[model samples]
Target: MTRYHPFLVFLHWLLALMIIGGLIMGGNVLAETPNDDPFKLVALRMHMAMGILILALMVIRLVVRLVTTKPPHADIGNARVNKLGTAAHWLFYVVVIAMCASGLAIANMAGLPAIVFGGSGAPLPSDFSAFPPRMAHGALATVLTLLILGHVGAGLWHQFVTKDGLFGRMWFGKRS
Candidate 1:
């Protein structure tokens, strides 16, 4: 098949938009809002919900990818670069899952479920920096951002430079 299964394509684009939105909301909106702000709770609830959804969808995507037939890997005439592409594709799964895990750890550690979701009157912690997973979550966010940029750059290269139609492989089209 030259193209991905329709469901996979759907998940690809859906997850792409969601991951980007989650990153922006977490990094900008949530970051700028002080923990004491009442709106901070609202933002946290949204961000947390999005993160969880992303995680669940990723699991479904992984399963679909494993059981479905896909187009052969693209070749750019460089073995090293080709291997790098393969590794990066797999890394997306790893990094995203890790990011979700760290986010969940932070939530549990900080009692976010009670404060943000349970409507508990307890105040949010003065700072989340005290949670060890907070550090990992921040680091994973940076890594996820970089990986996304690289993935986009590689896709553009395939489409505009190599002219190999690699971009279409992950897009919607007839399987063969």
Candidate 2:
């Protein structure tokens, strides 16, 4: 039996909070942006920055998971909990990476400068000019919706049915 990687657990929940918050906020920003307003451009640029940060943190998380010895799990925790978790996590990464790429794509379609969260800027790859970022962003958002539903369902299962400690690790930083 392996012990829960406490630090990894912390980063996981923290990133989840940030990603969900950013997504919800970005959606509102996009909806509220006026069709003819220049301010919409600025808001999109900032959304790009937020996407970049999410990408970087996700990469860091992947690296950490690669090097760490993940704790063991008991089968009875939930009937299909492990499978759902694995799928949800990988899909979560896919949607996040796609969101970042799509944000850059949309910016390129407008011929705008790259919005780098870490520094002054980076140029958008010329390939991003092919189409609007909306397609990819929309696809990612759709998947994100499903994943969020799956995640919540799993949590409720743990809370009400299985009565397990799985959710506790991510929610409160340790097993109850």
Candidate 3:
């Protein structure tokens, strides 16, 4: 079986790290920082930056995927599994795009607080629920987290239970 291209592998791992980091930062900014905390805006800004980077990288990754030759899917003796894997991959892209869009909408609706960038503080909305984008962003994030867990579990299952060497397809370097 053919292995994934090196650039594709790089993009995969890079985006994975960025996405996970963004998620962690977002959680900290949203849950850990009190609304009254001076640093809350700073955290929000950082998360926003991370989200933008993810969006840019994801766009580039999609373009690369479109132009490059992808390895063939494994014939794991089950057409249903192959279809599920394909659908899951697409789901990841969809969720990421949705998350970024909603996040941007939230920032826009909130007027992109200048305080997030070290400027004088601007008052945030006292009620986040008043912003429809905030609600969508939160809901999408929850779905993304669940999808990530399912993706990881599927990878592990392929690596161990299936033993089809499918995991090696995404690993770095040449297959032995």
Candidate 4:
């Protein structure tokens, strides 16, 4: 089995960590932070910044994927499963980019005070439901979360049941 390029593996894990951490932090801020708390604004801004970073890194990942060669994927003999895997991979890219775009839209539509990096707070437009993008942002977030779970489940299936070692392709370590 051909191993993934080291740089691609690095970006994969880095983005994964950021996305996971950002989601946890964002959820905490949303559920626990008081509206009057100054930290809430900072947390929200940082979440937005992380989304932007994810977007930038995702674009670079796609570009790198195109320019570099990937190891040939072995078919698991189930045509449906193969197709689903391919679809899921593409959907991962689409959902991530959509999430970032929708997040920006939500921020732009919000009418709350937001603090950007290295800048003071500014009042944003606050009615999220009044803006279509804000609604989409919420919906997309749910979709992204579900897709991530499905992706992980599938990887586990390949690793344990199928015993194909497919998960190791994206995992860190020396290439065999």
Candidate 5:
């Protein structure tokens, strides 16, 4: 096939927007808002819900990817660079899944489900830093951000510099 399955393409773009938005919401809005702030609860509710949805979509995307026919991997005339590209694609899945898992860990450990979702009326912890998973969540977010930048850079390079049409493979088009 000359292009990715349409469903996979749709998932790729959908997840891209969700992941980027989630990172911004988590890193900026949620991070700056103190746990005591009433708005923090609202932001937490939305952020947690989005994270859960992203996790579900990612799992489905992975399964669809494994089962679908896809174009051959792109080559940019360097074996190491090609392998790095392959590894980075796989790493996206690993880092994103781990990021979601760490977020879930923090929520469960901090009793966030009861507070944020269940409306149990329990107060949020004075600080999330006390939770070990919070640290991992932040670190994974940084990694995921870097990976995204690199992926975009590589795609641009392939499209503009190499002129290999690699970017089009992941975009909407006829599969053949």
Candidate 6:
């Protein structure tokens, strides 16, 4: 129910783009394509790499969140809404970190080099197997999807029904 801090807003959008890209790549066309195909491999690899970046960014966001005091939910509709919103935010954080941790472990085991956004060479240990990467990739993808649905659903409820400032905290105002 509290307004998100400025840094949280920045991190949310930053992570949002990464998450959206992965979601789009998860489309049926992309999922059904052969892994051996160069284009398919590249696309999959790109998605995996983006997942790695998200892992890193989420870590940073968690650290920031831990140290900062969140803004008040004084203007929020009521106690029930505020509690749900708060729980949803923490769920988001927990799921994201879980996904990231799994992804990084997979990357380490899969021998796919770590990928940095707009940068080169994150060189993961070469001995890591592809299995861990594949497993983590699947697990994290599932978690991210569920959390996303919950997030969107809550946003819609706030925007359409309560006329609360919940969405605006992340989209426009600080937790208003």
> What are the models' TM-scores?
0.98, 0.75, 0.90, 0.86, 0.99, 0.70
Model 4, position 47, has a per-residue lDDT of: 82
Compared with the true structure, the alpha-carbon lDDT of candidate 3 equals 0.80
Tens-place lDDT digits, model 6, residues 53-154:
887888889898788667665346578877876787788777777766766666555444534232344433332234655566566677778878888887
Task: Encode model 5's per-residue lDDT on 1-176: one tens digit a residue.
Answer: 89999999999999999999999999999999999999999999999999999999999999999999999888778899889989999999999999999999999999999999999998999989999999999999999999999999988888899898888888997788
TM-score of 5: 0.99
> Taking the tens digit of each residue's C-alpha lDDT, what string does model 3 give over 80-176?
9889878889898999999999988877777775546547567766545677988888888788888889988988887899887777788777743
Off by over 4 Å in 4: 31-34, 111-115, 118-121, 124-127, 172-176
Q: Which number leads on TM-score?
A: 5
In model 2, what lDDT does residue 100 have?
78
Superior by lDDT: candidate 3 or candidate 5: 5
Order of all candidates by TM-score, from best down to worst?
Answer: 5, 1, 3, 4, 2, 6
Worst 10 residues of 6 by lDDT: 121-130
Candidate 5 Cα deviation (angstroms), residue 156:
0.7
Comparing 2 and 6 on TM-score, the stronger one: 2
Order of models, best lDDT first:
5, 1, 3, 4, 2, 6
lDDT of 3 at 85: 79
Residue 121 lDDT (model 2)? 49
Find the 10 residues in a row with the least total lDDT in model 1.
167-176
Better of 3 and 6 by TM-score: 3
- lDDT top scorer: 5
C-alpha lDDT (0 to 100) for residue 64 of candidate 4: 83
lDDT of 4: 0.76
